[model samples]
Target: MPTPIIIDCDPGHDDAIAILLALAHPGELDIRGITTVGGNQILDKITDNALKILSFVNADIPVAKGAAAPLLGKLVTGEEAHGESGMDGPALPASKFKPVEQGAVEFMLEIIRASEEKITLVPTAPLTNIALLITAYPEVKERIEKISLMGGGLAYGNVTRTAEFNIYVDPEAARIVFESGIPIVMSGLDVTDKAAIFEEEIQELKTRGPVSVMVGELLDFYSIYGKKMGFVGNALHDPCAIAWLLHPELFESEHLYVTVETEGKLTRGMTVADRRKKPDQPANTEVLLGVDREAFIKLLFDSLERLDRQLGSPAGES
Candidate 1:
């Protein structure tokens, strides 16, 4: 049986690829729906980008818009990275899928309550939407199998000198999710940065076939922003969470007690993972520490190629 999952994202460039990966690996994952949050850009843009990307892949997943900001703090958008449109890569055809009226949090609760099997929550953006769902409907907590989120870092940070973008955007929400007692598998920058998507791979994506070509164009557009950020290459951040579902062996993780800094002015949104020597806090998350980049990228590109070959064009491809 395929693992049923719900992707909560902000449609960052890598988020686009994450959707494609989920669509490609049908047996490994059953996407219940897509929920958009405001992190990379804003609620409207992220929702639009979610539909656009899924449509691009010809995936028929429903989409819902979530919170426009965090639980208590002002929403800090990542215009520097994802651009004004959230997903600024290749010209995506206009989205044919409109967002449902229930909103992301409600939609998440509805599906989990209705499904007989537990649903995995893969949150690749800020935790606002996920946190909201858990808080608004505490009864559904038992229905959630786990939350696989892409944020925080064991070592470095991108948004601040100590925090990653997703968590940094909404530290309070992150704090709630960490303390919510649901099992979490955190695919932070610690592992994601290790899985860099570089130029050679991009070339392969371009010439490997037509589907590869589309992925290549998306990456090409994605890379321009990366170059400006001194990445020298792209980090498959969002996709790492989806990849975790398909290929868990590519990454190394440790069971640890993880908490979010919600009130500290200097460390807000920072994941306070207790990687300490002989600690007493109950470990709640499997925090990924490293990844086999070569294998990881190979899986991604190959999967996209497979989808392209099968469908000929993205579902929304004109």
Candidate 2:
């Protein structure tokens, strides 16, 4: 049987591709639901983007909207990176699918409680929803198999000198999750920055099929932000989380005690990974430190090609 999982995300351009990749591999992943939280944009916009991606893929997974802001801070969006419409570039039609009437926290609770097997969680946005779920229902912790999240950085930060965007957006939520003691696999910048999609690769993807073309367009727009920062291509951030689930061998990780800094003036949101193996700090996170870039990209391209074959022509092409 496929590994049952839930995807909690804010549909940034990369998040859109991650959804497609997850949906493409039904044989490998039985996606139970998609939950949206506020990060790349507001709750409404991100949720709408999630609906749009699911609609484009003709997927039937349930989506539920979660927190609009962090537990204790004002909502901050990465408009400069993702554009005004969190998922810019793709001339996507309006979403036809509707999210579940129940809130995201409730949806998570129901799914976990009802499932006979432990479910994996792939969180590609801020940790708000995951934190809320844990806080509201402490019993559900035992039901989670693992949390593969795209956030944090072991080295330099993307948002600030000491913080990554996702965790920085909601350090409090991240703290709650890190301290909850659930198994965690963090695909932080240490690995994601290496999962870069270059211009030539984008052009090649466009020829693969309609879905690939749409993904190429999304990456094209997403790459602009990275170029400005002197990067060769855009980092496939969210997809790295999913990729870890699909092919753990493609990544090299370290077991460490990771904690989120929610109260540091200069280091708020910084993921303090205890690499030194301090006696008091028990290892809490499997922090991905390296990735085989070639294998990672190949996995993405192959998955997209498979999706293209399965879904037929891209929407509006026929």
Candidate 3:
């Protein structure tokens, strides 16, 4: 049976690809809906981007807008990285998909309650919507299979020396989710940094086919922000979570007690995994620190190819 999942995201370029992967690999996962939150951009833009991406792939999934800001701090968006539109690089057509009337949290509760199996929460953005849903419906806690999130870093950080953008955007929300006692699979910077996209790969994608053309276009738009940030290539951050789900063997992780810092002058949102030499705290999460980059990228490209075909276009190298 395919694992049922709800992707709570902010539709960063990588987030767009992650959704495509989930929808494409029908045998691996069953997507319930997409919940948009404030992070890579403001709530409205991210939600709009999510709907747009689904439409691009001809997916008919429902969308729900999440919190406009974090639970305890002012909302901060990465306009510099994702642009004013959140998914600024591609010149996408107007989205045909529309958001449902209920808010993200409400939609989440209803989906989990109705699903026959425990739903997995894949959050590739700030934890605002996931935290809110968990808090609002404590009864759903035990029903969640696990949470797979993209944030944090065991050694270094992208947003701060010790934090990732998603967590930094909403530290309080992250704290709430981490301490919720649910099972967690954290694919932080430690793993995603390895999932880089080289120029040749993007070019190959462009020539491989039209799906490749779309991917190439997407990456072209995605790479601009990365170059400005002093990165040689763009990392497909969001897809790491989906890739981890598809091929857990490609990644190595440690079971540890993880906590998110909600308050600190320089450490808010930092995922403080107890990597200590000696500690009494029980392990709560499987924090991934390494990944097989070659395998993951292959999985990603293959899945994207599947989606292109399902969306009524030919995809190469499948």
Candidate 4:
């Protein structure tokens, strides 16, 4: 049976690709629903973006709108990287699929409580909704299989000198989830930065089909921020989370006890990973530390091709 999961995201450029990657593999993952959080952009924009992306791929998945702000702080957006609409590359047709009325936290609780099998949570943006779900309804904790997420890095940061954008947007929520005693697989920037598809690959992907062509355009715009960071191409940050869930062997990880710094003045949102050789803190997270970039890129293209086949678009038509 396919592993049931919920994709909680903000529909950032990479987040859109992550959803496409998961949906392309129906046999491997059964996505119960997709819930939007306020991260890359505002709640309304991202919720609509989710619907548009799903419609773009002809998927009929449930989408729920979530928190518009963080638990305790003002919301910080990634408009710098994602652009004003959150997904700012190719023009997407307006989606006929609308989000369900239930809020993200409530929808997640209901799904977890009602599902016969355990459900994994894949969060690719700020963790406010996950924090709210677990806190407001702590009883659902046992039903969650695990949380595979995209945030945090022990190596360095993007928002501040030590914080990534997602965590930095809502560090308090991140701290709560990190301490919630749930098993976690973290696809932090430690490995995500290496999961890049360069210009050559992007050019090749554009010819695959409509979906691949749009993905190529999305990367073209998103790569601007990556270029500012001195990368040859844009990093597939959000897709790294899904990639690890589907193909763990393509990457390497370290079992570490990690926590988000919520109160530090200059270090807030930093993932404090206990990497000491003989430290006594029990490991809590499988932190992805490296990836086979070639294999990662191949997996990405493979997903695009599969989705193209599903959409019935002829090869090399885009």
Candidate 5:
């Protein structure tokens, strides 16, 4: 049987691809629901982007609006990167799908409690919703299989000198989740920065299908910053979480004692990974340090090919 999972996202350019990648592997992942939080954009924008993207792909997954702000601070979005629309490049149809009436926490509680199996959470956004879930309903902690999240890093940071964007957006919430005792798989910048999908790949991807074209266009806009930084390609950051869930063998990881720095003067939102010679605390996060970039990209391409098969020909292929 496929493993049950929930995707909590912010619809960053990479977040949309992550959802498509997960959707393609219906046999491996029984996606129970998707919850949207404020990160790449505001809750309203990201949530609508989620609905529109799923509608484009004809997926039936339930979506719920999540935290509009962090647990303790004002919301800050990655709008400078993702643009005003959040998903700027894709000219998607207006969403025919409406999110479930309940908020994200309640929707998550309902899905988790009703699932016969423990649900793994794929959080490609800030930790706000997850923290609220566990804090409000402590009993649900035992029902979670694990949290496979795209944030933090052992030695790299995207948003601050020592902080990654997702965790940096909501350090208080991240702190709560990191300390919650649930097993975690951290697909942080250490691996994700290496998970770049380059120029030629994006160009070729556009010809594959409707989904591929959408993804390719999103990547086109997304690659500007990476290219400016002189990276070989754009980092497909959020997709690393789903990739880890599907193909753990493609990545090398270290079991480290990790904590979120909520109150550091210069390192707030930094994930303090204890890589000491002999640490007292037990390992809390499976910190992804390296990845087989070739195999990981192949996995993404193959998944998109599978999705292409499910739909009709791409536009202009008639």
Candidate 6:
């Protein structure tokens, strides 16, 4: 049976690709729904972006709008990296699907309570919604199989000198989730930076088909931002989280006691991973530190090709 999962995201370019990758493999992952949170953009735009991406792939999954702001701070968006519209590359057609009236937290509780099997959560954006879900309904934690999230960094930070964007957007929420005692896989920048797709692979993806072309365009736009940050190509940050769930063999991780620094002025969102276990805190997260880049890129391309074949359109037109 496919592992049932829910994707909580902000629909940044990579988040869109992550959703596509998850949908492409129905046999491996059964996506219960997609929940949008405030990151990369505000709640309204990110939710709309999520709907449009799902529509592009002809998925009929449920979508729900989640928390509009963080638990304590004002919302911060990544328009500089993702563009003002959040997903700025491809001219996405208006979404045919509409989000359910139930809010993201409520929907998560409902699904977790109703499902017979444990559900895995892939969060590729700010963790406000997941934190809210846990805080509002603590019992749901037991039903969650694991949380594979894209945020934090052990080496360097993208937002601050020590914080990544998603976690930096809402450190308090991140702290709550990190301390929630649930199983977690942290696909931080340490590994994602290694999963970069350069110009050659981007061009190759464009030639695969319509869906691939769309992915290629998204990556192209994303790569420009990467270049500005001194990277040779775009790092598949959000997709790494989903990719790990699908192909754990392509990655390596270490168990560490990780905590979010919610009070530091300079490192508020920093993930303080106790690799040496000096704090004597019980290990709580599997912090990914390495990836087989060749295998990962191949799997990503193959998944996009499969989806293109299934959809049979460059823009998903039947």
Report the number of backbone clashes for model 2.
Answer: 0
lDDT of 6: 0.91
Better of 1 and 6 by TM-score: 6
RMSD of each: 2.5, 1.8, 1.8, 1.2, 1.5, 2.0
lDDT of 5 at 147: 97
Q: lDDT of all predictions, in order shown?
A: 0.85, 0.91, 0.85, 0.92, 0.92, 0.91
Better of 4 and 5 by lDDT: 4
Model 2: clashing residue pairs? none
Off by over 4 Å in 2: 314-318
List candidate 6 segments past 4 Å from native.
277-280, 313-318
Using all chains and alpha carbons, the TM-scores for the candidates as numbered come to: 0.94, 0.97, 0.96, 0.98, 0.97, 0.97
lDDT per residue for candidate 4 within 181-279, as digits (tens), equals 899999998999989889988888888888899899999899998888788877899999999989999999999999999889999999999877655
Candidates 1 and 4, the one with greater lDDT: 4
Residue by residue across 1-318, what tens digits does model 1's lDDT show?
999999999887888888888898889999999998998898898899888877766777889899999888688888777677877767778987899999888899889988999999999999999888888899888999999889998787888877999999888889999999999999998898888889887876776665567678878877887798778778888889998888898889999998888777777778988867555567899999889888998898778878877866542343
Model 2 quality (TM-score): 0.97
- Candidate 5's residue-wise lDDT over 150-239, tens digit each? 999879688889999999999999999999999999999999999989899999888777778888999999888677767888999999
Instruction: Mark the regions of model 1 whose C-alpha exceeds 4 Å error after superposition.
Output: 277-280, 313-318
Residue 34, candidate 5: alpha-carbon lDDT? 99
> What is the C-alpha lDDT profile of model 2 across 71-143, one tens digit per residue?
9969989999998889899899888899999999999999999999999999999999999999999999999
Looking at candidate 1, what is the lDDT of residue 304?
A: 81
Which is the leading candidate under lDDT?
4
Give stretches of model 5 more than 4 Å off: 277-280, 314-318
The collision pairs in model 1 are: 57-315, 58-315
Q: How well is each residue in 1-318 modelled by candidate 6, as lDDT tens digits?
A: 999999999988999999999998999999999999999988899899999988888899999999989888689899988998998988889999999999999998989999999999999999999999999889889999999999999888998999999999999999999999999999999999999898998988777777898899998888888888788877999989999989999999999999999887888899998767565588999999999999999889889878888776442333
